[model samples]
Target chain A: MILHGYFRSSAAWRVRIALGLKGLTARQVSRHLRKGEQAAPDHLALNPQGLVPTLEVAGQGALTQSLAVLEWLDETQPGPRLLPADAWGRARVRALAQIIACDIHPIQNLRVLQYLKREMGQEQPAIDAWARHWIATGLAAFEARLAEPAAGRFCHGDVPGMADLCLVPQLGNARRFGCDLSPYPRILAVEAACRALPAFMAAAPEAQPDAE
Target chain B: MILHGYFRSSAAWRVRIALGLKGLTARQVSRHLRKGEQAAPDHLALNPQGLVPTLEVAGQGALTQSLAVLEWLDETQPGPRLLPADAWGRARVRALAQIIACDIHPIQNLRVLQYLKREMGQEQPAIDAWARHWIATGLAAFEARLAEPAAGRFCHGDVPGMADLCLVPQLGNARRFGCDLSPYPRILAVEAACRALPAFMAAAPEAQPDAE
Candidate 1:
């Protein structure tokens, strides 16, 4: 298998954590997101969405979307599952992941920020505010969710699953943007627990080979 | 089964289509998003994410996130599967859905648009442009992906499943924003094909009881 990604891409980071938890390895190919490599013909052929973390398995073809890739990995591979056993538990975990992935992460992606600058002409301070505003609001809700009885040491059960994978990366981005973490106690604690696990640590953007 | 959702929420609309496709009915309750009913304490307790399209099965707990809820629906209920049988096919279909759900739809959501106004002080035209911009770009990629041999009448092989469920709502939003659709011919064709279906038509926002 081969993984096509850009280092700072949170979606790709999620896939890396899932693979690490599953103890799977694939050759890494970095597409410089800032350099517009993802939109190039070669990359678009792999993923028409022109996004990072397109995983090309030996036979299963190039898989885009980090969560979908994680699900496929969970289905095909054997090891620590990245989700809960019961259907309801899985739903809770997914809702947590989507809180970050769908609500927080998408709004602050690099391309969107660039568009804010180049197209919309949003000033730097305004853009940064936009980014921090979303991260803070979304994380607050996620932090509240983590305080629920269903939350164990990780985002769901004791095991680090899909929700944990998503939370860690978004928090990593939060810290990157200098967003205040003090408000989200539960999310902060979960991030700390996730950091203790080698899988989440290994998937951090700065820990990757392509990190700047 | 019951679904707590707003009639106009694209996220909820996806679940409505899925339920129809599976020959199932969710006892519906509308938390009018336009009226800020989703932020109510009762709704928040059921779904921590505070987003709509929370599916409550009689025996199982509530499921959130349109994609995850759709997957659980596919898994538990015996009917037309929302995902493809093969792994590669599933990946493709999922990628298609995420391009809309994870990429296009979230940024243009009512809350986010409201944020651009209340917090960022972005004027209406600027906010509308932001909405159109993301939808147009995301749909362009979606159109190219559909050009692949994999796309039949629906986003995948002729059946309307997860991807189709995602696509129609987005196109509806695009039309609402008065976005130019000529650039995405294949996407427009797929939207037309999906709109013709009774399942899609019945699930439309305008057809809902609280559409006003």
Candidate 2:
């Protein structure tokens, strides 16, 4: 498999964590997002959205979307399950993951930030504030959800699953944006637990082959 | 079951379509998003994200996130499957759905536009343009994906499933934003097919009780 990704992309990072957890190895092809390499013809052909983390499977073709790729990996590959076995538990975990993937990360990704700068005529400080505002708002909600009875050592029960995959990468983005993380103690606790795992450690942005 | 939702929220609309597809009825409790009713204490208690389309299942607690709700219904309910039976087909459907859900919709939702106007001090025209830009970008990608062989009358195969559910509502948003639809023939074709379905017609935003 060939994973087209950027080292610092939270979406790509989620897939990296999933790969490590599944004990699967894929050759990495970095599409430096800051340089707009993801928009090149080849990448766009593989992933029409021109997004990072397109997983090119041997016979199945390229799989776009990080969550979908994660789901596919869990369904087909042997691994520690990224989602719980039960229906309701799966719903809870997926909802938690979407809290980050759908709500938070989309609003503050590199392309959106670029639009704020180049198109909206926003200054660096304003752009930074924008990123921080969304991150803090989403994390507060995530923290509240973590206080629910279903949450345990991870985002769901004692296992690190899909939600945890999302949470850890988002927390990475939160720190980079200089957002205050003190308010999300539960999220932080989950992050600490994920940090203790070798799979999570190996998937960190700085640990990637293409990292600056 | 009860659905806490606002009539025009694309995310909530996705859930409504899923419910219709599943032949399930949920009592609608309108949380007026325009009036900031979604942020009220009661709504927040059920959904910490303060987002719409929280499906309150009897004895199952609130299921937040429209995709999660849709998946739960498909898994547990005795109706048409929202996802495909095969793993690869499911991944394709999901990745196509995320093109709208994760990338386009969040960037142009009410709160983000409100932030643009209130926080960034953008004019109404600029805000509308921002909405149009993201919609066009996402739909172009979506159109490209739709051109793939897997796309039949609906987003995948002849059945109107999860990807179609997301596409229909997002097209509503795109038209509202005045985006040029000429660029996406495949998307428009799929929308036409969905429009022919009774399930899709009933779930239209204007067909809802609180549409005013």
Q: Candidate 1, what DockQ?
A: 0.70
Off by over 4 Å in 2: none
Candidate 1, residues A1-212, lDDT tens digits: the string is 89998789888999999889999888889999999898899988888778898999885568888888988888789999987888778878888888888889999999889987887777999888889988998888888888878998888968889998998888878877889999888887788889998888887888889999
Q: Clashing residue pairs, candidate 1?
A: none
Q: What tens-digit string does per-residue lDDT give for candidate 1 at B1-212?
A: 88998888898999999888888887889998878888899888877767898887776566778888988888778888999998778878888888889999999999889987887778999999999999988998898889889999889989888999999988889989999999888887888898888888889998888788
Candidate 2's TM-score reads 0.99
Query: Best TM-score goes to which candidate?
Result: 2
Report the Cα lDDT for residue B55, model 2. 93
| TM-score, structure 1 vs. true | 0.96
TM-score of chain A of 2: 0.99
Model 2, C-alpha of B166: deviation from truth (Å):
0.4
